[model samples]
Target: MVSDFRRKKLLHMYKFLDKDGSGTIDKKDFQLAAESMTKQRGWKEGDALYKESLDMTDLVWNALQKAGDANNDGEVSADEWVTMWDTISKSAADREWLSQYCKFIFKMQDFNNDGFIDSDDYVAARSIAGTSKEDAVAAFQKLAQGKSKISLTDFQKLWDEYFLSEDPNAPGNFIAGKSSFD
Candidate 1:
C-alpha cells in the first residue's frame, strides 16, 4: 500500500513526467523532456551531446514503459505509475531502474559537469522543468543540507528516499521543489 506521503510524491513525479500536461506519460513526454533539456543546454540537433541525450531519454522511456505500463497500453496513467512505484518500493532488487534514473538526472542537474550539484545547477535544472526559481532555491537548500553542493552519492540516497520514504519530514521530500511537499 502506498502511504499518503509517498502517494503525494509519486503524483508529483507523474505530473513532471506528463510533459504535455496530458495527464499520462508516453514516449512523447520523454522526447519533450529531452528536447527541453537539449534546448536549455544549447545543444542543437546533430550535436553529439544532443544525440546522446536523446538516446538516454529513449532508454528511460523504454524502461518506464516496460515497468510501469502494466496494461501494455504504451502509456502509463497515474494509477499505474503509483502501483509500479509501490511494487518497486517493496523490492530492493527492482530499484535498479530507479537508481539508474537518479544517476541520469543527477548528471543532467549537474549542468556544469563539475561533479556536484550546487544551487545554481539545481535552480537551472528545475527551471527547465518549469519550477520557479524561488522554489528551486528552497529545494536546493533543503536537499543540500547546508552544504555548498550535493555529490552524486548523496543525490542517490536522497532520490531513493524521495520515492520510498514515508517520512514527511525527510529532506528528500523537497527534491522536487516546494509543490511536492505542499
Candidate 2:
C-alpha cells in the first residue's frame, strides 16, 4: 500500500502532469509538457534547448509508459500511478537513470549553457510548469539560498527532495514550480 503522504504527492503530481486534462497521463501529456517548456523559454525550431526538451519528453514518456501502463493501455490512470509509484519507491533508486534525467532537466532549464540556472532560466522553466515569473522568482530566491546560480547538482538535489523529502519547507519543495502541492 502507498503511504498516505506519498500517495497524496503522487496524486498532486499526476494532476499537474495530466496535460490533456484527460484524468490520465499519456505520451501526449509529456510531449505537451516539453513543448510548453521550450515555447515558454522561446526556444526556436533549430534551438538545442528545443531539441533537448523533445528528447527529455521522450525519455520520460518511455520510462513512465512502460512502468505505469496497465492492461497494455498507453495511458496511466490514477490506479496505475499508484502501482507504479509504489513499485518505484520500493525499488532502489537507479542513480544512473536519475543522473541522466536530471542532466536533461537541468540542461533544458540552463538557457545559456552556462552550467548553472539563473533567475531568468529558472523562471522560464517554471513558467512552462504553470508558475508565473513572479512566483518562480520568489521560489527561486529561497531555493537559491543566496546564490546567484544553481548548479546541476543543486537541481538534482532539489529533484530528489521533491520526490523523497517530507519536510514542508524544503528548498526543493518547489521543484515542480508550484508553491501549493495541492
lDDT string for model 1 (23-128, tens) is 9999999999999889989999999889988988998888889988999989999999999888888887666667778888898899999999999999998988
TM-score of 1: 0.94
Q: Would you list the C-alpha lDDT of every candidate in the order shown?
A: 0.88, 0.79
Q: Write the per-residue lDDT of candidate 2 for residues 1-182, one digit (tens) a residue.
A: 76566567668888888988999999999888887877777888899768877987888788777777877788899989878767665675534455677788788778778999999988877776778888999988988889999998898888777666666778877776666654
Every model's TM-score: 0.94, 0.82
**Model 2 ranges off by over 4 Å:** 1-3, 42-49, 93-96
- Candidate 1's C-alpha runs over 4 A off are 179-182
List all candidate RMSDs to the true structure. 1.4, 2.5
- Output the number of the lDDT-best candidate: 1
